[model samples]
Target: MPGKSLSERIADFGRRLAVEAHAAWLAARDPRTPWPARLLALAVAAYALSPIDLVPDFIPVLGWIDDLILVPAGLILVRRLIPRALWSEFHAVAAAASKHPSSRAGMAMVLLAWAAILYIVYWSVRVAPVH
Candidate 1:
């Protein structure tokens, strides 16, 4: 396809955003994260990556609603698990990542490169001549 159809492009963008949110959740939960908030981060990351969901992604508009809900809910759950001071520190880091352009650009470039490499490998394998 010369360019993705509008719906395809939108779907791709939504998926990317969901992945980014998941990454942010993981970073927030790192053990090195303050003792207080570490568990919260872990819980959020686990839930985000988990196969189980409040609403499965296969559904129409309702599917992604889980992404919107789970992330914040996980954060709240983490906050309850940890002390306020530590949660503040992790939140600060999350805010910094959200503001950082280089990190976002790097992630996008890496994903694009990975996609390109996978496409090339698949194409080569499919078109390879028989011995």
Candidate 2:
């Protein structure tokens, strides 16, 4: 097999991070999970999935701070909180999810949903009764 390009590897890593965050989200809700671990996992997953960032991505070097610093740090903290046995299971699930090809159709659907929402807002503003 040919060696993967740098971009491919980076994309794979990003997928893995998303997968692991999702897995942790699931694990956090389990009854057996410790409260502290659950809290950390939930926070980490929420931060990772949130569209709004602590530092907006358009802000040059500062924009990347949350992504480069906070996320990895949160993931590491969550890992420490999880018990060894459960961590292994979460790792396995994350690894499996990361290996599958991403769905372009799903991406399109999300984009369409956002467009529809924006259009609705625009139309509402245009047609609203004058105050």
Candidate 3:
């Protein structure tokens, strides 16, 4: 890190994020993971692994929020909830990186979620008292 250039540091961060997401996915499926942690981990994995972005990249500021803030926060929370030893084991596995990492179903799930959000917004505007 001390010797790394800005681009190198950014690349390292990206790689670390990918590794953490991979680790979360691996941990979610493990029976050893506690249910609460597993549930959060699964959600994080689905979003991170999915090719489609939940908030589309064309949306400006909101687009990067999930990737930069949400996923990492979710991973941090999950890391705290999971036993350290188990997480360390999965982290190593994720870093070694034997993964296919396709998520077509995750794409469908993201679309549905966006539709539901849009519907809620529409309904709220329709029902609101017009001042």
TM-score leader: 3
For model 1, residues 1-131, the per-residue Cα lDDT tens digits are 59889899878865544454454464564665565465555455555544455455789989877676656566556667656665566556544564422234334444666678889999999999989
Give the per-residue lDDT of model 2 (tens digit) for 67-127: 7777878888888888889988877876676343333433454466667888999999999
What is candidate 1's CA lDDT for residue 29? 43
Off by over 4 Å in 2: 1-3, 97-131
Q: lDDT winner among the candidates?
A: 3
TM-score order, best first, reads 3, 2, 1
Ranked by lDDT from best down, the candidates are: 3, 2, 1
Residue 43 accuracy (lDDT) in model 3: 86
lDDT of each: 0.58, 0.74, 0.89
Per-residue lDDT of 3-122 in model 3, one digit per residue for the tens? 999899889987898899889998999999999999999888888889899888789999989888988999999899999999999999999976647566668889999999999999
Q: Report backbone clashes per prediction.
A: 2, 0, 0
TM-score of 3: 0.83
TM-score of model number 1: 0.39
Give all TM-scores, in the order shown.
Answer: 0.39, 0.65, 0.83
Off by over 4 Å in 3: 98-100, 118-131
